[model samples]
Target: MRAHHDRAARALGVICEGGTEFWGWAGRTLGRAGTATDGRRVWLRMLTAREAKATGKLWDGNQTAEKAFGTLGGRRPELLAVHDAAETGVVYRAELSTRLDMPVVSPDPVLRSPLSLSPGWWGSLRTALSTVAGATTDRVAVRSAYVERALPEFVGAPAPETIEWVTVHGDLHWANLTQPRLRVLDWEGWGQGPRGYDQATLLAYSLLQPDTASCIRECFPELGTAATWAGEAVIVAELLQSVARGDNEELAPPLKAWAKQLRERARK
Candidate 1:
């Protein structure tokens, strides 16, 4: 793993400059993320590919963000450069952005902290959500077919109702969000999806911490509304699949309990 990290660092250095400095790194299921800097101006994220197959276009969330920044503009990283290797199926994407103090919370579900987000922060989040929700996009991040197949595995069957779809961050979680200043990161999966999908995903991830989950629910009342229930159902099914795949084992117990609770509530 150290060797891979070193190689990624070198690759990012070559892309940025000869004097790029390594900031930090963490191993992920799909790939590894390393923060690098060229000293004075920008911070570069070197994303080394692992499990992601070379199928679609080279750009993902970064591209979506780049397009949205022009009009939607708030606190999002900008795409700097992309190094694609079709033959090796490895892609190195570099993004430039201002450095953040710390993440709002750890990406790992095992970590817990007392809820500390202020009302202003919650309001800012709502504004960001509105910005993304109002934006236009042709990309389909989560396919309806996959949702249809996964929903029945946990929820038995879907109820007959009209679902309102909108542009969503698609992969909104703790790690992708920064605190104090409130900047949202990781745009690789931003696209059109069922309304409230981002909020449901965040709520799903916060299940391990009851206080935090409740806080999120309090802030985003849509989580309790019937209109967004379909979106929440998708999140539950997605999390359940993650548990079955042996991913996020730390979150499995709470996630399963929450799934059961959601199921019971849906039937009522």
Candidate 2:
């Protein structure tokens, strides 16, 4: 870790504070700078391959939040600064200074909301989906197939129109958010798709009790109310999508419950 930190410092050239234990950068723009402490510096993330993998997972989970930020930046250009993104990392860094020492390391509000399934959020999701669909050259069908094949039980039942097309933060959860203004971040897997896609994912991640989920849904009537079956389908699809690539331990339990919910609902 020390070597990694040192390498990062040398590469970026800043006073690696916290004795290289913490990830940050320190350097000088002008000579004899005190009281000022060169508050004009940024830190490099010094993560090992394992940590890097974890970061990837985090990014994957927060892909929606990141995409949302990008969407917002495009529409409201004044809201954020466009930082140069590395070839292998998420694009667009938030101007943390505006948030007053709020580093981009916390969860976002969209992630924390009760999963009432907001129709209001539909506007953002719709825009996001259109953006992705528009960007691709010709493989919209192929990717849509990936989604259906990946989670047929869930996505298959909800046909094109029935499901409603809107830009969704495909991966909406607690960790994907930032505090204060609830800025969403991460954009690796963002694209256009279903309207309830964000809602279902948000509910699954709300960590609220069943009743709470119901209340939250009511709070956002515009998102439209859903049958238990709909929620089940979402779980099944999300689980299948997460595991089809490979069975991830983290998503297993919830996905299992989702399957059971679908089965139980079908029986009724």
Error of 1 at 100 (Å): 2.7
Candidate 1: tens digits of C-alpha lDDT, residues 1-268: 3344345446655323345344333542123333455543344554555436533432456765777764245566555545443225555444455455465456553336665788887888888888889988887766788767877786555643567888888888887777776788777677878888899898888776788888888888888677677778788788778778987667777767766765676787
Clashing pairs in 1: 61-187, 61-188
In model 1, which runs have C-alpha deviations exceeding 4 angstroms? 1-40, 48-58, 70-73, 81-89, 107-111, 159-161, 264-268
Candidates in order: C-alpha RMSD to true structure: 4.5, 9.3
Alpha-carbon TM-score of each model against the true structure: 0.77, 0.48
Cα lDDT tens digits, model 2, 64-94, are 3333344454421121222222324423221
Candidate maximizing lDDT: 1
Which stretches of candidate 2 lie above 4 Å from their native place? 1-16, 19-142, 153-163, 207-215, 222-235, 240-268
Clashes of 1: 2
Q: Identify the leading candidate in terms of TM-score.
A: 1
